[model samples]
Target: MTVFRVGCPHCGGRAHLESGEVRLARTRSRTFYAFTCPDCGEPVRKPAGERIVELLTGNGVAEIGLAPR
Candidate 1:
C-alpha cells in the first residue's frame, strides 16, 4: 500500500500514511486520507491523497487540533 511520510512539526516526528478508510481511535470511520503521528500521538485528516503535501507542511491543522491561541 502507498504511504506518506508525515513529519510532526510539533514533536519533530514522522508518521506513515495509510491507505483506504481511516478509522479513528474510537473506530469512527472517516471518508478521507489520513495519517497519525507516532511521536506526538495525533491524528491528521486529508481531504484527498493528492493533498497530502499540504497537511505535512503544517496546513489545515484545524482538523488535527485547533488554531493557535
Candidate 2:
C-alpha cells in the first residue's frame, strides 16, 4: 500500500491518496477516486493514474507506501 498527496492546481488545496485508488481514471475505466478542496470546498475526481503520479513524483509514477502512522 502507498500514500500520495496531491496539491490542487486550483485553490492550492490538498488531498491524500491511499492504496488501490489510482490518481486518475482512464476513459471507460470504472476506478473511482475523490479529493476535497480545503479552500473552496470543492470535490475533485481523479482523471488518470499518470496525472496523479506526476503530481507526487514529478518525474513518473512510482510505488507508494501507506502504512498507518
Candidate 3:
C-alpha cells in the first residue's frame, strides 16, 4: 500500500496516511486534499495541483465535488 505523507500544522508532526485516510475535494477555483492529522487529530487541507489530483485519484482516494456557485 502506498502511504501519503502530510504535515500537521497544529501538532508539528507529519502523518503517513493511506488512501482511505485521504480525501480529494474540488471547488470552483481550486482542488484540495484533506486528511486528519494522526498526531493531533486536527483536520488538514492542502491545495492540490493537476499532478496531485491524478495521483490521489489513481491511488484510490475518495473524491468529492463541491457545487459551483
Candidate 4:
C-alpha cells in the first residue's frame, strides 16, 4: 500500500495514510486535498498546488468534485 505523510494542525501531529484515505478535489480556480488525521482524529483539508495535485493523482489517490485536465 502507498503511504502518504499528512499533517494535522489540530494536534500538531503527522501520520501516514494510504492512498484511499486521501481525497482530492479540484475547482475551477484551485485544487485541494483532504484527509482525517489518524493521530488526532481531525478532518483536515489543505490546498493542493500544481506539484501536489500531480503527486496525489499520480499516486492513484481518488479524486472528487472536479476532474483533472
Tens digit of per-residue lDDT, candidate 2, span 26-64: 334343345555567777765446555455445333443
Candidate 4 residue spans exceeding 4 A from truth? 66-69
- Of 1 and 3, the candidate ahead on TM-score is 3
User: For residues 16-50, what per-residue lDDT tens digits would candidate 1 score against the true structure?
Assistant: 65432232121233324455667777776434443
Q: How does residue 37 of candidate 1 score in lDDT?
A: 65
**Regions of candidate 2 where Cα sits further than 4 Å from its true position:** 15-32, 49-69
Candidate 1 deviates by what RMSD? 10.0
Residue 15, model 1: Cα distance from true site in angstroms? 2.6
68: Cα error in model 4, Å? 14
lDDT of model 4 at position 22: 99
lDDT of 4 at 34: 96
TM-score of each: 0.37, 0.36, 0.89, 0.87
Supply the TM-score for candidate 4: 0.87
Residue 40's lDDT within candidate 3 is: 85
**Could you tally the backbone clashes for each prediction?**
0, 7, 0, 0
Clashing pairs in 1: none
Among residues 3 or more apart in sequence or in different chains, the pairs in candidate 2 whose N, CA or C atoms overlap within 3 Å are: 2-64, 2-65, 2-66, 24-48, 24-49, 25-47, 25-48
The deviation in Å at residue 39 for candidate 3 is 0.6
Worst 10 residues of 3 by lDDT: 60-69
